[model samples]
Target: MTIPAPLNGVVPPVCTPLTPDSEVDTASLVALVDHLLEAGVDGLFVLGSTSEVAFLPDAHRRLVVETVTRHVAGQVPVLAGVIDTATLRVVRHAETALAAGADALVATAPFYTRTHPAEIAEHFRLIARRTGAPLFAYDLPVSVHSKLGAELVLELAAEGVLAGLKDSSGDEGGFRSVVLGARSRADVDGFSVLTGSELTVDSALAMGAAGVVPGLGNVDPAGYVRLHRLCVAGEWALARAEQERLCGLFGMVGVGDPARMGRSSSALGAFKAALYLRGVIACPLTAAPQLPLSASEVAAVGKYLAAAGLL
Candidate 1:
C-alpha cells in the first residue's frame, strides 16, 4: 500500500528508545514502534525533538529512520525529522530517507539561525525542489523561536509544494491564520495543518487541524484516538471536556523538574515514563543527561493520572 500522507488520525511523536545502559537500543526501538502501532497510532516519527535528535549522531539517526521504515513495512507513513539549521543537511537527510523508501519527510526551519520569513521560505523551497517529495513544515517556535509565518507557508503551498504543516507555534491566532489563509485561497491545496502541542489538540482540530503530532499522545495513543473520534463526531461537549483533561495531563508531565532541560528533556522523557507506567514500554529509559524525575513529581503524576482515571 502506498504510504498515506500526514493527514490521518493520530501520529505519536515516539520517544527514542534506549538500552538500560542509556544507548540507542535497536531491538527495543523496534519493539516500541510495534507496540505503538498495535495501540492504534496512525504514523510514527523518528529523529524529532522528542526523539533526542540533537543527541543522536547522524549514523544513529539514519539507523532509527531506516529501522522504522523497514519495520513499519508501509503499514503507515514514517516521518523522519529532517531538522537542521543548514538547508543542505536537511536536504541530504531527506534524500537519504527517500532513498530508504521512507513515505514522507517532516522538516522545520533553521533552528540555530534566527532567519527571516523570506529566508525560511527559500530554505523549504530548496528542500522541496531538491527532493520533489511531499513536505510538511514544522513551526515549532518555542524550540527554534524562528516563527514561520502562515502567509509564508501559503506562499510555499502555492508553489505546488508544502503539503502540510505541524504548527508548534503555540499560538491559536497563528493556527487560525493558516486555516483561514488556506480556506480563502483557491490556489492552495487546503494544506494540512497539524497540532504539535497536545495542550491545544482539540482546539486546533476544531479549527480544521488535519491531525496531531505530539509526544503526549505517545503516552496514551488511545486517548488521542478517542479525542479525534469525538472531534470528528462533532461531540463538542464531550470533546472539550476530554480535551481539557488531556491538556491537564500534558501539564502534569513536568512540574518543576529541569532534568530534561528544555522541552526535549521533559516531553520525551516524561512520555516514556508514562508509557512505562502504563506497561507499553519496558524501560522508559530516555537518552542520557535526562535525569529521572523527583519522587514528589512522580507521585504527583500518579495522583494526576488517578484523578484523570487514566493511571
Candidate 2:
C-alpha cells in the first residue's frame, strides 16, 4: 500500500517482542501488530527506538521489518527505521528494509562522531539518492546528539529530499515553526509533520501536525486513535479529556526505579509489561543489557493499567 503523502492518524512505533533467549518472538510480535491494527492505528513503525533497534543486530532488524510487513500484508504502511551512525550503513539498512517489503523508511542524522549541518544535509541527500524511496527525517536529538533544525528540514522538504518529519526533539517552538513553515511554502506540498510526543498529541494536532508516533500507543492504541479522531473532528473539549486520560496512563513509564535502570529501560519495560499484562505479548522481557523491571515495578505498571481501565 502506498503511504499517504502526509501520513495521518496514530502510527505507533511498535515494540519488539523477544523470546526468553533474546531472539525475536515472531508469534508475540504478530499478536502485538493485531492489537494495534484492531485498535485502529493508521500505520506501523518497526525497528524504531521503541523497538530496541539500537540493541538489535542487523539480522534481527531485518527480521522485524520482514515479519511486520508480511503480517500487515498491505493493511497499513509499514515504515522501517534505517538508523545507523553514518551514511553508507544507513543506506545498507534502507536497502534491507525496502527489500523486506517496507513501504517507506525513517532515519535520523548520523551520530557517534561529530557532524556539521552541511554534512548532515548531505547525509540525507545521499540516502535519498541511493534508496530512491520516500524518507522521513526522525528529529530525535536526544539520541542522535544533533538536531535537525527547522530550516534544514524545510529546505529538504522543498527540495523533495525528505518526504516528512517525525519530530521527537521535544522543542515545541521548533516543532511549531516546522508546521507553520510547511503550510506557508507552496513548494512543500505533501510534507507531513508528525509529532512523536506522547503527552501533547492534542496540541500537536491542533497546530497542524499530520499525526503522532507515540511509544505509549503500543499499550493503548485505541486511546490515541480516539484522541486523533476527536481532534480531527474539531472536538477540542473531548480531545483534551482523552489526551489527559492518556497522560495519566503514560505515568506507567516511570514505574521502573530510576536508581537501578535508565529511562529507556523504564519506559520500554513498562510498555512491554503493559502488553504482557493486557495479554498482547507473552513476555515483557526487553533485549539484553537493559535492566528488567522488578516484580514490584511490574505491579506498579498494573496499577496504572487498572486506573486507565486497560486491565
> lDDT of each structure?
0.78, 0.96
What tens-digit string does per-residue lDDT give for candidate 2 at 67-128? Answer: 99999999999999999999999999999999999999999999999899999999999999
Tens digits of per-residue lDDT for model 1 on 199-264?
777788888878888777776677788888899899989988888888878876665367446555
- Candidate 1 error regions (>4 Å): 1-6, 256-263
Stretches off by above 4 angstroms in model 2 are: none
TM-score of each predicted structure versus truth: 0.91, 0.99
